[model samples]
Target: MTEDYAALVRDDRVHTMLYRDPAIFDDEMERIFKQAWIWVGHDSELPGANSFKTAHVGRQPVIVTRDKAGAVHVLLNRCRHRAASVCERKKGKASVFVCPYHGWSYDVDGGLRKVPFADGYREPVDKADHSLIALRTECYNGMIFATFDDAIMPLAEWLGPARKWIDLFMKQGAGFGVKTLGEHRFRFPGNWKIQLENTTDAYHFPIVHKTFLSSLDEDTENLMDVLGQGGWVEDLGNGHSVMVMIPDLIDLEENLDAPIPDRFAALAAELAAEGHDDDQVRRIVRAVGGSGFNLNLFPNVACSMAFFRVLRPVAVNETEIQHIAIGMDGGPEAANRARLRLHEHFQGPMGFGTPDDAEGWERVQRGAAAGDALWVMLNRGVDAPDGRPEPGHEAGDVSAETGMRAAYQMWKRMMTA
Candidate 1:
């Protein structure tokens, strides 16, 4: 199945085996996830010099750490002796990581800092040679990513037009930038691709999230009705793409129940000092850091307005998803709490939106196990104009499968490379 993904993948749709085949899943781990720039975590997650987090780049365990000098590094978590993991913790501040197996110690910079019994060694064990394997790491706008393949393109070049959307999301906080509030994780009994495709799928909103949408007030419902009409999808180059809903739902002031965020006030004051008026401040706040964009970073990262979705593939039929709510760096505590509540409303395990989506994805997995379903149709908005210069209207446009197609195209390129 891995050998002939091109033959298996339909031009307009993909076969069910793509989701159920173990061989294809293995190939994906190697060809797609490892080769691409997989987002490890945000820089804010490890702000202190000794802060660190454990992440998986595809199936490979990785440690993302900041050295005493403040340089961030991504290294394989395996120990040199017997291949034991050097760090078992998920996240914490540590001066050094020691292999529980042989007490092989490594500094935060991934250099071999010490060895338990160096005098007993017969053959000379160079500390440099025994250090943890390092992967190519890069950061863009404070987002950290690592790749197994050093030949891969730089994050900036790979991001292309998608960088603009990232900038917009970053602009939410006055000048401090965005931070991950917290994450809710869950396993879906389905392939990772199923969830990735759903992120940009505007078609599913009215039907799948109908109950949640209906719960909103009349104005919000009107906006939902328009959203149900369909929206613009664009190919942001590389494997990145976007599915935008028009008029920027977050921009509407009808539901400003949350207290004004202190960051917003600070930004407003800064703008005022720079000679801006109240209306300009309001407009800036209304944008909600690019409230209109559902930006997708190819392979495994997605930033949907105020929240983030990180995809982790566990196996052929199982995927783990992490939903993170973002907040302003120094924003009002109340506003950040409101953002968390809003995230919980939709993305939490028992939330109004995620449960339904997870159910749908699980059903897809179950159905695909039959091995007879040949095509999962993705022909929605295949002929629509690609959203480019039109900005907000792109979110309202219906005929746009550009995002999905872009992802699949990248998949094909990587698989066949």
Candidate 2:
């Protein structure tokens, strides 16, 4: 069945075809992922010069590297000669990237450094001409992002309202800032949009994550329930969005099993050595925000509390998700371990949350294969609250499908452009 892209979306609801259609998925890769300032990795991921990580901007393979001067660069992974990926490993520190196929090598800055048998060529391969294709890379609050399209707007202008949410997430550790706690990668036999929608989806939590929530103590359950009740959902413009569920957790009674991590203790000790008092350290660690907040950056990044989730599409019906957790850098080792444990609880492949969500997404994919399922209703709490700033919320309001709607709206705009 042919799908009307415009008709598939209304202010209050959307059709399932938006999620199921292969054509729409291809268009999104071009108009959305290719053009958008997709999150590549955190600044902390590449701690020093020569550190690099491979990531995908849509289906195109890209590499993010830190040069000797500590400058970050994003380059197309293809070799100039025959288009083979220069960096094969997922991540590592290297002064230069060498292609194993034909021994073509480039510096960490993506400058063409060496080519095997250079003298044999009639037209000398100009190092500048054969340099790896570079992408526009920028950082905000230590988060790295790159755009394939040179004409795209600056990162700050594109961030819009989403910057506030990122600021809040960053504020968690305050001056101590945050650091990634590695990641867990998994593949889902479903569309990537299915996972993106879930990032801001609050309605399904109480049901889908019921068992997981039940595992937590009463206090945690109360917080989860509060999140289910209603929370902030905001469209931060340019398809970026934030779904704040609960505020900072400083007020909560510390559960025995969930005590301040020993890493925090080490951090406190370090702070003490640096002349900070006990109170100051306590305040800093406590303020490292983690209650229940989910912040989504446009097409692919979701910063949820202490963790970040990146949704990468492999196919119309296949997706790969990477979950990365972050904590204060060199802060208390205890706190960092605690954050890792917390991430493990929900983000791990077999963790309480992800596996459950995966099941739901797989079901959606199976249902969509029928072809007769025309739409996926997003009419939750349509009349329950008018929390949006505009006349009609553009997906990002309590009980609102603001994020989903914002994504589709951007999709339609870009596709039609």
Candidate 3:
């Protein structure tokens, strides 16, 4: 019998089975991932014509390529002939992909270029019919997404209210434009939604990342106190949410004249010495620090403060995460260096934050095995101080579980549809 997904996901809690059930995970791969526009890659990753990168849309592997004509395409990685993967390198500029199994060649646009020993075929192989299977692809800002369901709504309409927050998040480019510098990929024994829940989860930040906060300078440590700040979380429609951790840093360009922080003071001086004016130095410095909010896009990707958090489900009890560090595309070297250093300090592989978060997610999965009927409580912000939302805060305070609740509701909607 098909499970009732709506019953499993309530307004304030979700069944533990949602995390531990293989059936539910498989259903999610088909219903949520295949039907929704899954984030595949960034425009910057495919720097120019003929560049490509490999990514996963749920469990199906796909190749994201920019053709010689500069158009982007997401094609099935498997060869049209023998099902062998046509290309395996992580990313690079490639004009043609040759399958190692049978030496079938394909173009950057996934058009079948040549088949080895074509004369051996009894029938003429139609190149148009044999090209790599392509999916419906779309991009917003620099984020690329693909979907198997061509009937689904356009990406922009699906994004809806989330676009505003995405625009603010991209302003970290500081007018130079945002580009991917690198990424850290790690796996933990836990459900993907656990890490998804972590994106907008402020309640666990202080407790889990205590060491990271302690490592920060005094002034910066105070600034990292996200829960105590007057910031709040808002439920952007379509299951997306934004957790504003530092209200003052919400719009990086708004406070260009603000005094530079003590930590960045030296960097600011360095930029000025490099011939940048006071205004340019301030803009670059502020951008290097990243935005103040974590915008969790539904299902797979998140703009988490300084980096992009992407989750891929390996199994019912396994999930792989990518913490993609972004920097100014053509900005000064010193500024990008500072941004990389800051990213390394907290979000890197050996950094203080990710390890702690992975531990917490693993523990949650371990504990889920203990009880068969227990529910994962998500009632933190169900009721406000006065039993009503604050003036501008319809979701809740910074530490609320409103974001997770929003995600599960969308999950229920998709799974039942």
Q: Considering every candidate listed, which one attains the maximal TM-score?
A: 3
Tens digit of lDDT per residue, candidate 1, span 274-389?
66466545544554433655788898989786677899999989999999778778655544565677678778689988999999999999988775757776655555536432
Ranking by lDDT: 3, 2, 1
**All-Cα superposition RMSD per candidate:** 4.8, 4.5, 1.9
TM-scores for all candidates? 0.88, 0.89, 0.97
Q: Give Cα distance to truth, residue 138, candidate 1, Å.
A: 0.7
CA lDDT for candidate 1? 0.77
Question: RMSD in angstroms, candidate 2?
Answer: 4.5
Q: What is the C-alpha local distance difference test score of each model? A: 0.77, 0.77, 0.90
Q: Report clash pairs, candidate 3.
A: none
Task: Give me the runs in candidate 2 sitting further than 4 Å from their true place.
Answer: 1-4, 228-230, 248-277, 284-291, 371-373, 383-397
TM-score of 3: 0.97
User: Where's the lowest-lDDT run of ten residues in candidate 2?
Assistant: 248-257
Q: Which candidate number has the best lDDT?
A: 3
